[model samples]
Target chain A: MEAQGVDVVVLCGENNVAYATGHAAPSQEPARAGATRTVAILTRTDVRLLTPPPLDFDDGVRELAAAIGDHAGTLAIDEYPSMLVHAALAPHAPVDARPLLTAAKFVKMPAELDAMRRAQRINEQAMDDVLPALRPGIRDTDLSALFFRRIFELGATGNTVDPIWNVLPTSLADGPFTFTGHLPFPLPAVGRVLEKGDVIFNDAGIDFNGWASDFGRTWYVGVDPDARQRSQFRRYLEIVEACRAIIKPGASAWDVAIAAREANGGQPPWFPHLYVAHGIGTDSAELPFCGTDLGAEIESQVIFEPGTVLVLEPVVWDDGHGGYRAEEVIVVTDGGCELLTDYPHAPYE
Target chain B: MSKERVLDEMGRREVDVLILGREGNARAVSGAHRLFLAGERAFSPGCVVVAETGAVHVLSVTDFGVPADAHLYPPSWNPATLVGRVAALPGVRSAKRVGVDGITPLFEALLTAAVPDASLVDGEAIMRAARRIKSPDEVDHLRAAAAVARSTMAVALNGVARGLDDSGVVALAMEAMAAEGTTTAAFEPRISRAGQRVTVAVGVLRDGWEADVTRTAPEVDRPAELVAAIARCHPGVAVADVGADVHGVGCGYEALPADERLEPGMVLSVSVAGAGDTVLVTEDAPEVL
Candidate 1:
């Protein structure tokens, strides 16, 4: 705040509120989520929160204005409610707080890292129960059912996304058409039943007290991998290893992006719309995003600090045959990055 | 028919174009099955509805059951890029008034700069009016969603009877809902245990519509408060007279004002405090689903 010369900072987005206040709320659809937002106000000296039961646009703006009191300094805000803009904030022209937030949240503290580790442990253990139940007759939603039940039982605040257990086609031509022509992935699960040899790309995320755990791996139903599939998995590991080799404190995001592309023969190994590695904290995807549309210019400027975490996901596409995809959660250290994702890459492994 | 209804509302409100930011509004407008990501997001243009051409352009990477005529654009992180796409839509740049469900400072600037002549107005009220009356297909989807909610709800009630903890009961209920092919939940199943009484509520979203059901342990007759609320759900009665907490249960939890009148084809989820079932209001009577 001092660096930006802003006296008051207001946040309305849920993840930003959670990050500011250390409070977690039940996740809902967008409309309900907006209507039931929890607003947080941070001044250099004090912090205040306006939770639900009184959070419509008009009342929220009034409370926010009241909280600001007589401060005449500049205000930074994460979201703009039109009512707020038309009423109290039209004069201030609130500066965007995302850059300030990104800088502050880029490096995780020890306690935040511990929270993430616990969240990942819950996610992985739930998968341990889910993986054994994957078979030919089980539908995609059946896996989702088991996964949801296990996560709540094991203690998750909420499920982050509809658990994706997408059954990928052998060729991109057979998959859903995309404007980018890159293979679309992580589509919502339906009642599609698994076949004996179908390859499944699994991805799920859950919230544990405002911390997010992102899990991704590839699975096969009722069959061992063929030689081509095994080769795909091996190649995926090679790309991951290449990225991991240079993920030390001083390394730039561009260096990791370059290593993954070079390991995959100069082609970006992840989805074009997505990233090679994204930092995850309160939000499932956050700062230090590498290999996204932002490209090399922005990426080279993103330096990895000691406590920065990255989820490295690289897909090894064999085109005619199915491919292998997995993600590793690693935290940068003084020496190198340490793996936070411990789920085994079995069947493929 | 849904699009026609929305267009009619737009004509009534004199909105030249609509830029829907909420996922439910976008889904309601476009009839697209986009990926469901949980939690609140900052407002950005997700779907654009051009009044002049009646074209719905969605921000999607792939056409996941999107209508054939609807255009798809890959998601962008840059606000300028998004504004540019919205500007290029057939009628957006020439529009005199652009209605948006929500906006942020950055998008407001970008959009204003891109379309210099357009005035950004509140489309939320227009959407609420358009969405108040459910179409026949929307009713069917909501009915199916209610059935899906009941499938898991029974398991939850059973768990409450079986001496399970709140987490255990909720876990079983969610699993059952998913097994029925509904992975998205409209609301987290709220289960609270207070001495002898255990209140369990579960809601699910199937095909972008919502249905919510709630029950308590030691199942008894419907509470008088809720019964009175249901009885008052006639075509012209004001919702405030219902004497309970009533909310519209459709694409999402539609938070209507107390004075809003109940109309035929409006589906509502009513609870005194927290024991409610979804009710469909019609000209003759209220049907509980």
Candidate 2:
């Protein structure tokens, strides 16, 4: 943005807030009561931290003041406003801070890459315990509850997102009868049960040390999957692997996306249109979005440098059938890209 | 059982011999029992405990990392060298590699690796039936959360003004909540600008509307008459209809025409406009909690 002659940049989005300040209320849950909301003002040589009133008047402000003092200037602020108001006021700073930082975070730093890898390891462990617990009579909500309980017990704060529980039914009507259907439901109920031959899909993430690792896995309940279903699973895994294979330094996000599409028989999943890939860090979604029209190449000639973290997911869906997609976290490096998630992409038995 | 009876039933199902595993079953039962078990390490992916009578044997893959002694584990030599060890003490049995779902192919793998002869039982019915009603402690926490939300609204109303936008109101409310030590707002509050005047017909309109139309009759000197006029207006009447009838009346001309009904528990923002000036009235004078 500085090269483009833009002087100031203000960030108000939840993810942007996390990038600016270490403190961010989890997107999946409400903020703990009395936690301080923060706004950071970044200039060429100085950084100022602004906090909301009452919270700032208390000990939180003093702690923030001390933390920010090492950066440059004394913290200066107006009244701490809502996230929206803060975004509006963000650009008023002397220099644009968002574009600069966003470009920098496109590749993962070594520490961030390590965090993602650790998070994925924990996720795999949780899956090891969770997949077997799924049974014919288990309710979708009950399964989610178990996932939450186990993940938290394993030392994770919580799941990165609301665990998506989809139960394959004998017919489309039977499938849509679930509580949440498709409209993104919140909370869980105990009465919805799993039936025989149900193909259960769990699309969830794990938060380790404030970093997130998300992936999706499918399970066949009560009976073994059929030949066609098995083949579909293989194709899904192949698509994800194809994307990972070509994802290296000097590659474009579009190229990675296209590789996954081509591997899936030229018909990519709905996920590509929904969200192909994005940078991930403290906040779940970061910068450097991968889509058809992004135009930006992934080479060194581009602004994004090494040490940036990214999530690559290619989705495939059929209108009459259902949805299948696989996701993995990767870090841009000097040599190529490093895969953070090491779990096998095949369906859990 | 009725929805309220679920927790009681679960409490009754707790066994004296508890097994700590690395899975949800152990966590749920432990949380339900509130008993701290000592010494039992998470043996493998699955943990098991058998009661003295052997009537109830709980199998789970979730690990809580409780002590080894609180719950018994399988005994094995060279605990240090064991990649995955199964220990069976005097009264307890532990499994090293149990799958999460006891019915899947992985479950078979877990059973073969640990106790292949263990019987499969359905526990979902028992567990789901237990978490329905909110316990007293849960209720208390929810009430506390609601109070925080209400107080946050109070702060927003106090800070609202004509020039202030929606974002300003939201900030003020959040700031108040933060000051009060509440971490976040339960929901976003609604704020919008007041509209211009309109007309209303009698009979079709409510008593509050008639009272509003006639508000000019009451004055500071005539307290009784003002009270009488107020009495004529029903507490449940809609604020908009009332404002419409009194649009040209003394202070009524300045009233912002609002369409919301006055409910007993409602937190209202009562405003009146006159001579290009505005006045706001709130019940109990909303304050930052």
How closely does chain A match the true chain A in each prediction, as TM-score?
A: 0.96, 0.73
lDDT of 1 at A206: 92
lDDT of 2 by residue, B1-289 (tens): 1122322442455422232232334433332111111111112223343444332222211112232233423221222212133323333234222222112222323434445444333222333334222344433333344454445544554445333444455445444443443322222233444352111110100100001111111120223533332332344556554342221111001111244343322212122221010111123332111
Candidate 1 ranges beyond 4 A from true positions: A52-70, A81-88
lDDT of 2 by residue, A1-349 (tens): 3454543333323344444555443322212111223455554444455554322122443444344344332222322212223223233332324445656556566676777777777777767676776778776655554554455445564344545565544333433222213312112222357787766555677666557777666677778767666766667778767866776667666666567668877765433223467767765665656653333354223333567666776655444554455667777677667777777744443
Model 1 residue B82 lDDT score: 74
Q: What are the iRMS values of all candidates?
A: 1.8, 23.7
Candidate 1 residue lDDT tens string, B153-233: 889888888888888887898899888999999977898767788888888999889999877777534777778788888
Clashes of each: 0, 44
Q: What residue pairs clash in candidate 1, if any at all?
A: none
TM-score of chain B of each: 0.97, 0.30
For model 2 the interface RMSD, in Å, equals: 23.7
What's the lDDT for candidate 2? 0.41
| lDDT of model 1, residue A17 | 83
